[model samples]
Target: MSSNNNSRTLLVIALVAVVVAGTVPATVAGQAERTGGTVVVEEGETVDSLEAFGGTVIVEGTVTGDVSAVAGDVRIEGDVEGNLEAVGGSVTIAGTVQGDVEAAGGSVTITEDGVVGGTTSIGAGTVVVDGTLEGDAEIGAETIQLGESASIAGDLRYGGNLQGNTDAVAGDIEQDSSVGVDLAPTIQPIASWLFAAYALVLNLVLGAALLALFPRFSDGVADRVSSAPARSGLAGLGVLVGVPILLIALAITVIGIPFSIVGAFAFVLVVWIGIVYGRFAIGAWLLSLVGVGSRWLALLVGLVIGAALGLIPIVGGLLNLLVLLLGIGALAVGLYSHWRTARRREREPRRGVGPDGPTTD
Candidate 1:
């Protein structure tokens, strides 16, 4: 049961990572693009960075910067000059990483030929180390195994059952199950509050950026939500319920997997944008009530109120959901309206004034 739970948690984490990687803009210097299919760095090839989702990621060449993936499997057979971060069904590293390795998944395996030059942190159902790690290892899993070939130059800290070859060398070995317990009742509430605060700040920052980048679209979404509350809410509810069903149906077909992944990514992106727009709308309304007309002030006030409401028990959750729905609907409607208007204008017959002073189409 514990192993099963851990596996499920890893799966959830992988999916969430996929959604995030699909939506968030990449900041890498080279090869920054989104793909629903596998990303391969073939032998003798090199890349500055790579981010992929849905399909397996195989790195058999070299990477000068970070490599991240959320997929079925991540296999590193060459060398990573920088950090490697991955969430997947399984992670297998048989290469050399000059920087850190952070992985969360069903299983993490560092082959006998693998070499990690920096810290290695992993959370999974099972972990097997049969390589050389020059830095500390922090692992949380249901089972951990260190093979005879394993050599760690730094401290080893782990939770859960452990088995290792006596020949395995490490600076120190320590068991710390208490860290796992802290994730439960003891500190969950505090963690939740901290996460909420962080989310509030992040949203505020993103919202401000969005307002600056697309002021007209932002205002249109907010106005639509205010002008058609019922319609927007209903549309949002439909999208919230319908999109997942569509994705699941698409996933049923083997050839449709990529499409489903892309759809899922788009859905998540829409929800996030909707939530930001909804919060901005709320802030705008609050400011209007106070006879203030500053978008910045409105955003600050709305975010504070929304974050506070989120702290509430059941009511807060429901309110947030409603707001999210409203925002999604409004954005969708506004975009559609704009597109239709553009199309109609393009289709209208061009008119010219003749010398007779009569307009002709």
Candidate 2:
């Protein structure tokens, strides 16, 4: 496919993913009021910014906070205090931003006068930065067009195999990133290695124990990750954002006692979910090993070998991602399994519940 066609395809996929994953709708196009074919956030508008608006957003106003739009044609003509994350058909930065701009679209542009204090990243066809990117500009695209006025304070990294105009990068060149490296420098390699190794070892031990004493628990966890990603994701997000807020609110009101208690329990559930995911990954690996060799040695040999390989530096990060992906998948599957089992056994139970409303088994 042509580069434009490829970019358009990815853009559509990303738009769908954002909507499904976040599920929060926002009509922020009216931020600066409408004018002509553009939806402008005109000057002198101080606000909470916007989120998930599906229309074109043309901003010429002042935003005190972050602005995020899903599937909007994002055009920034104002100043924003916080970051801007946009997934749209097209993105254009015509003003200034005090923070980063993360955009994914068919095409992106930053005009000569546009200024960004932080990074500006794009995943699309062509990124013409005829503006100033005070921080780095990372792009994954078919071509990068650098105008004569373009300047970047940091390195410019590209995903597609292509060179740029000499004037495209008016900054010092950094190390060229490669696909074989899997963008390891973006994250801590040591941390990834440790996480992968830990996941392998811990899951192996848990899987072996489950196979020996409680095969049902192993089965339960795996089913949850695979079939109940929504619940897991919601549950995970709750642990990260909701729990802390719930606790603070608990201290504020005596009437909110129940909510605080629930938050505490939810925190525990998140940890349990993590454990369940780990064991499931280990179990899958064990099965793979047994399929290839001896069943008796699968429990011990699978973990030792898998984990040992995880400590191998460059390969470890990808291994860690694979383990995590499996664990998350397993959690969904495990949840579904648990739910079906519960419903099967309780077909004729009492309607008005009493501690029987899907208690953690």
Query: Best by TM-score, which number?
Result: 1
lDDT, each prediction: 0.78, 0.59
| Reference-based lDDT, residue 123, model 2 | 68
lDDT of 1 by residue, 1-361 (tens): 9986786566556545644543443332257443533567778877788876544678888888888776667888999999988777689999999899888777899999999999988877788999999999887788889898999889888888888873565578889975233322333344345446656765676677667656788887777777788999998998899989999999999999999998987887788778878878888877777788788887787777778888788999899888898889988888888899999999988888898886848
Q: Estimate each model's TM-score.
A: 0.51, 0.39
lDDT tens readout by residue for model 2, 1-361: 5986776566556544433322222224433322122344567766666653434566677777887754437888888888987656678888888899877666778898888899876766556778888997777666667777887887777666445455556566543444213322332243344345545544444445445444556555544544564565555444456657868789579878788877776654445445445435454545654564333354455455556655676786566445444554455445666799899888855555357565332
TM-score quality measure for candidate 1:
0.51
Clashes of 1: 0
Task: At residue 16, give the lDDT of candidate 1.
Answer: 59
- For every model shown, the clashing-pair count is 0, 24
How much is 269 displaced in model 2, in angstroms?
A: 50
